[model samples]
Target: MYGPGDVRVEEVPDPTIDEPTDAVVRVTYASVCGSDLHPYRSMAPSQNGRRMGHEAVGVVEEVGADVTALTVGDTVIVPFSWSDNTCVYCREGFNTSCVHGGFFDGAPSATQAERLRVPQADGTAVVIPEGTDESLMPSLLTLADVYLTGYHAAYTGGVSPGKTVTVIGDGAVGLLTVLAARQVGAERIILMGRHTDRTDLGREFGADDVVPERGEEGIAKVMELTGGDGSHVVVDAVGHLPAYEQAYGVLRPGGTISRVGVPQYEEAPVGMASLFGKNATLTGGPAAQRRYLEAALPQVLAGQIQPGRVFDRRLGLDDIVEAYRLMDSREALKVLIRP
Candidate 1:
């Protein structure tokens, strides 16, 4: 990205193994994440464009001598960030906060390209079994960030059987949160979105209701749905302040608000009226993708869930700019990139 609204695809050098723990992956599938829109809309101009994209699934082309878990020719899911799996934070299910971890966005190589240099390969990449069906690639790619992120929101919100979950966006993450909430046993899933097509998918993913209204009206609709008691958990997939306000508004006393969307603003209400008096807990951050990948992978391989269905459009590498535009305009739910 060279500046806000300017995405240029220029040729760059291919990646190679750079460290003893690094591995080079030949990306087969990569996708534009909703979070990418943040920089797309407001990033400062730069002489050298930043590499975009973070979610990818690909084949390992080379591995460092010290990498024991992955070998050449292995297919792997590269999470949004890299980390040493043995680090204290990684062991505790917070790979994003690993002592030696960093995100792919500012790295020397990013997943949007045809190749990526993955640091800490053994700890960051999840190897897929050989001969897995190619059709599952999209689903597998979600394991890198989107699906796991939704799952993280529910996990942090303490979603469980007999609980009501209110997901505050109809984007891919929100739709998948509905799926994750259902998988984790949430009895009722309410989705807040204006788009019928996206909200329709949310319903297919197990949303019990969709609130097309916004602001106070939206909050009232959700509260009405919950019989004025509010929801047991509110997953804010949209990071703007309004989304956060809606989250608190519909949160049942003692319920949790989990925010998976990267926040666009820093200031928010945490005072008595918003949280303190209600004893509401605020949690969620960059997903522990490596940690959640373990459980989500098998389910995708088994065909029990098709989170990839969230992808509504497909574009080749050369059309990435259009892909971004489609998403920015809300014309595309999510776009799959074929490199």
Candidate 2:
């Protein structure tokens, strides 16, 4: 992205191994994420023609001498963030905060292109099972970011069988949260969203109820659904002031609210009366994708989850600029790009 509202696809040098632990991969599929829209809409200055996109599934074309976990020709999932996986933070399931972790952008390498150079290849990439069908690529690609993030929201929220889980947002991550909730055995999943298209998918993903209302009305509806007790777990997939407040409003006493949405607020109201009285717990941040990729891979491979369906449109890498335009205009849920 060169600046706000500008994305251009131009000829650029192909990626190559830059470190002893780096590897080059041939990207097969890449997708535009909601998070990418943050900078796209921001007034903050950005380097012109910086490579864009963070989610992709590709095959290893080459690996550095020190890389031992993967070899040429292995298919892998490229996560949004790369980490060494041996850092203290990674060992604690916080790979996003790894001391050596960084996003896939600029000179390091980017997934939007036909080729990418992945750092810390052994820890940053998750290899898929051999003989996997090409048709499954879309679903597997989601494991790189959206699915893992949604799963992290549920995982941190303490979702489990019999828990009443409420997901706030109908974006890709929110929709996948519904699926993750079901996988984790959530007995009742409530999805808050207004888009008819997304809501339909939410229902298909196991949402027992849908609340189209927003703010206080939505809060009341959720409280009423729980017999005035509120939900056991709330996943705030929309990171905004009102969304955070709604998540807090509908949380039961001692319940947890997992916020997977990239928060845009600089500050929020979280006083003791609002939290201490209810003992509501607030948790969630950048997902530790590496921790869940392997575990979630089987579900995608088995066809138990299909988050790939969230992509409403598909185009080639050359049309990535239009891909971002579609997502920015809300004309498409998510756009899948093939290189």
Best by TM-score: 1
**For candidate 2, lDDT tens digit of each residue in 31-129?**
999988887898466666567889989999999999999989999999998899999999999998989889885544788999999998999999988
Model 1 spans with C-alpha error above 4 angstroms: none
Error of 1 at 287 (Å): 0.4
TM-scores for candidates 1 onward, in order: 0.99, 0.96
**C-alpha lDDT score of every prediction, in listed order:** 0.94, 0.91
Clashes of each: 0, 0
Q: What is the model-wide C-alpha lDDT for candidate 1?
A: 0.94
- What is candidate 1's lDDT per residue for 1-339, written digit by digit as tens? 998999988898888787999999999999999999999999999887899889989999999999999989999999999999898999998999999899998577998889999999999999999999999989999999999999999999999999999999999999999999999999999999999999999999999999999999999999999999999999999999999999999999999999999999998999999999899999999998888898899999999999999998999999999999999999999999999
The CA lDDT at 292 in model 2 is: 93
- Candidate 1 lDDT for residue 84: 95
Tell me the lDDT of candidate 2: 0.91
